[model samples]
Target: MGRLRRKLKKTLIETSETGLSLELRLIGQFIIFLVTIMLCISLILVATGVFKAGMKQNIALFEKELSHLSQDIYDDFGNLSLSSVSLA
Candidate 1:
C-alpha cells in the first residue's frame, strides 16, 4: 500500500508540472505575436511617411524644371520677334 501511494503521488506531481510548462509556453508565444504585430505596424507607418516626403520633393523639382522650360520658350519667341522687326 505504501509503494502504491508513493507511485500515485509522483505521477500526479509530474503531470501538474507538465501542464504548467505548457501554459507558460503558450503565454510566451502570445506575447511574441503581439510584439511582432506592433513592430510591423511601426515599420509601415514610417515607410509611408518617408514615401510621402520623397514624392513631394520630386514634385517640387519637376515644377521648377517646367517653369525654367517655359521661360526659355518665351525668351526665344521674343528674340524672333525683334529680329523680324529689324528685317522689315
Candidate 2:
C-alpha cells in the first residue's frame, strides 16, 4: 500500500507539471502571434503612407503641367484670332 501511494503521488505530480508546461507554451505562442500581427499592420500602414505622399506629389505636378498647357492654348488662339482679323 505504501509503495502504491508513492507511485500514484509521483504520477499525479508529473501530470500536473505537464499540464502547466503546456499552458505556458500556449501562452507564449499566443503572445508571439499577436506581436507578428502588430508588426504586419505597422508595415502595411507605413507602405500606404509612403504611397499616398508619392501620389500627392504626382498630382501636384500634373496639375501644374496642365495649367501651363491651357495657358499656351489660350495664347495661341488669341494670336490666331488677331491674325485673321488683320487679314480680313
Please identify model 2 stretches exceeding 4 Å from their true place.
Answer: 1-48
Lowest lDDT block of 10, candidate 1: 15-24
The TM-scores of all predictions, comma-separated, are 0.43, 0.45
Q: 12-75 in candidate 1: lDDT tens per residue?
A: 8997887657778899999999999999998998888964768888999999999999999999
For residues 1-48, could you state the per-residue lDDT of candidate 2 as single tens digits? 999999999999997877657778899999999999999998998888
Which residue pairs in model 2 clash with each other? Answer: none
Pairs in steric clash, model 1: none
